[model samples]
Target: MTALTERTEVRPSSPSARSPLGFAGLIVLLVLTTLFVIGLAVSFGSVRIPVGDVWAIVVNRMLPGVFDVWWSQARESIVVGSRLPRALTAATVGAALALSGAVAQLVTRNPLADPYLLGVSSGAGFGVVIVTVLGFGAGMLGVFTVPVAAFVGAMVPLFLSLAIGGRYPQPTAIILVGVALAQVFSALITFSLLVLADERQLGSVMHWLAGGFGDARWSTMIFPVSALATVGTAMLWSARRIDVLQTGDDGAAALGMNVPRFRIVHLLGVSLLAGAAVSVAGGIGFIGLLVPHLAGYVVGIRAARLLPVAALLGAVAMVGADTAARSISSSLEVPVGVVTALVGAPLFVWMLQRRYRRAER
Candidate 1:
């Protein structure tokens, strides 16, 4: 079927979904909820800290000019040194992934268009593998190199997917191409580990591939957060255009909107956000695939409504998932990706069956 026809299938009939007043209220609640979740996450670690102290530590950090430092060095070290950064990074990456996923699904006019579904994760993984195998840099510079390479790597699948789908937004064909690309990258990642990486390196490589926030530092939050802020703002500002596009390209052009220009810009924005998220967090999947669908139950399919809500929901899910990953076992910490997969897989299956059943009915 034509891209236009396919887009028409999910056309937004719930125009009220973008109601400013209603969403403003929801946004306030979500923002507060997200803060609470962050605090909760900070309170739990290998050594549990009180929630009250967690907030106090955050307060001191935020208003150092005002609040006197009273907390012990160890307490300060635990909070500022590790937990806070991981918690903050989790929120940023989750929001970026979910927002990108929401836009991706809209851009492709497909229900399942996500960074992982479209090979962006594999591509990012490929980048990480390249850096790890090549010994690109060392010390501080080396730490930075992986993220840079991963961002570049993430773009590979997006561009390839576009090229493969070539002058057409055939969602089915594009998805298939993306899957194939992902497999190629996944195999290459394994090969790199087997041939290049040593025994001691294997464990870290595996964790990075699966996704974890263990190495997070306050410095880690900088790049992905900046990318998310810029691209996310662009997306929110273009919400009306996205709504127009949902009715398909013809509708957008008839309304004097630049459909092609919008799609090109839109793809770039998604790539930047999704790519940065993958680079920072490794291959944490399903926030993109799952969060938008859940948020859609409240916000409808419009970009304006879905984007922000999905972001908040995604933050909550990721923070919670990360918490579980680290907390569940003192001896063997689970990968955050595995945690998300456990939750996302069943939900994804249910969504597919429900969508098809609804379509049939």
Candidate 2:
């Protein structure tokens, strides 16, 4: 466990292993793969839509309402009205979470850094449970209720973390607080689940905690997708700063960045992104924790290159997970969170073993 917090010296001085054009090409390829995965996800469900008709419906919807398409309204409704938005939501949540995780790792300088690691997801989940326990339920805020509560809950921890850590993540103070909050919130959620939710509500609440896209809607998807776009664009621009940030506070300050202020601001931005995602999706874990490591392996730790790769990987992983969750069992759909955990846990174990092997060498 101590290995999780051990600071690693990023190999920034190594000669660039990738050319700009090559990196751009790789990113484009990954983006295409992500799109393909989303398409694949959209093509299957309780009522499967043919791949060709899926595109036609999407095209007709994208164009003016007058555009003619041969597809049946039910098929069009299934794709346009149901699965497309869900797939888009999955993609957006994946990208935002992976982006937030990467940023969290760089800022905290901890290999275990993730949206949940900082209590953001737990906070947001607690918010949802609170609303649910009160009977405010899903429609309380209309479409915005859960997400709004989630974003608000998520921000509280970020603020408290900064206050406790004095806006610095060094020496593990923030980590400790985050862990404490995570435990506290987990307890609260469990209590709410056991005491507050009825048997009929149990499945929904559990699915929410375990993470599912079954209830995804375009209205609920818009805010997080907007946050991802805005914050993701800012993240791309801040790549150089991110590199500087990984160099330690004194080093970054020496290089003309305001260490304290920068940490606070970046934490706020990432919390917003993570919070929005958590609000829409439930306590989906590990995509954020695991994708950044995979991205770093593909493109070095430099944020510019890492962000896109992470986003693509995250998007594909999420959509793929969602697709599998729905299709794997005829009797019941697995939660997307469970799929991610099943995938990520083994990867995490492998990474730990590889880390130890490197240490022995």
Candidate 3:
């Protein structure tokens, strides 16, 4: 047995060959895919522009000297001023949530986990309700109040869950505690909406809860993009530790890793990603839960490879969902969250069934 183990170790498969691409290739592909998807998403809406026109608009704006003759004020306004920012925001938020979910699942070692499973979304919703329903949007103070309230709301449940679940020991117990806190916060949100908000105010509150890209202004995109870049960089840097942790806590510790410290750092990063996403997107669901799992199944369970692939899949999913939400009805645009749920529910079930079948086999 000792000789066999030594032989296996000596002939161990190269990690580079296993992934079929270096880190540079992965990054370049991710960037190209992101740009392509963003362009596709921007060109599509209630009023569809031809693919040629889409590229024309993008090239004319991005490379004026190269495509100066293709410039048009009307097209640029429609694409650049309106659709481009919204599409980019959607991609960034989707990628952030998916990556956060991936990291959260790794840190918690819970198959059923998601970034916002710890009551983060509920907290953000509660914050938005307090600001919008209380008639605070018109004031100068209200400018930063919504996001501030959301940040506080997100952190509250995270710390509360940690406190209730005890120290960094049992992942299952921690997950259960998070679920309980989520339920409590969700109930609070419902009660506030029902008791404090009037009928007129309730309409706006419901709209926000349903989630849409309609609010994806330049100002709103700043925070989400900034948060995504920062948290994503941290996650990427810690990817190898995540892979080690997947081998079990004892295995990770035996390999000279500080398991507890790694978990804390990953948890904090995911929380920041989740909070910022919830603040901007207003509780878009299923992306975090579904995207990471899908990426794992498609690529592999290794967190390092799964991270960028999950981000791409998430961007594609959200951009497609948002397009459907806008184009589904001529008279009204459906909420992007509703569209995601409609599509994601069946896909999620299919994935679970496949996993079960594989396990049985």
| Root-mean-square deviation per candidate | 3.4, 2.7, 6.4
Task: Specify the highest-TM-score model's number.
Answer: 2
Worst lDDT run of 10 residues, candidate 3, spans 1-10
Best by lDDT: 1
In the range 163-277, model 2's lDDT, one tens digit per residue, is 7866554636665676677777778888888888888666666767788888799888887888988987898788789888877878999999988678666766777788888
Q: Would you list the clashing residue pairs of candidate 3?
A: none
lDDT of 3 by residue, 201-231 (tens): 7887788778778777777787778988888
lDDT (Cα, tens digit) per residue for candidate 1, span 184-205: 8888888888988887667767
Q: What TM-score does each of the candidates earn?
A: 0.89, 0.91, 0.87
Lowest summed lDDT across 10 adjacent residues in model 2 is found at: 1-10
Model 1 segments more than 4 A misplaced: 1-8, 17-21, 65-70, 138-140, 159-180
lDDT of each: 0.80, 0.79, 0.75
Question: What is the number of backbone collisions in each predicted candidate, taken in the order shown?
Answer: 0, 0, 0
Worst 10-residue lDDT window, candidate 1: 1-10
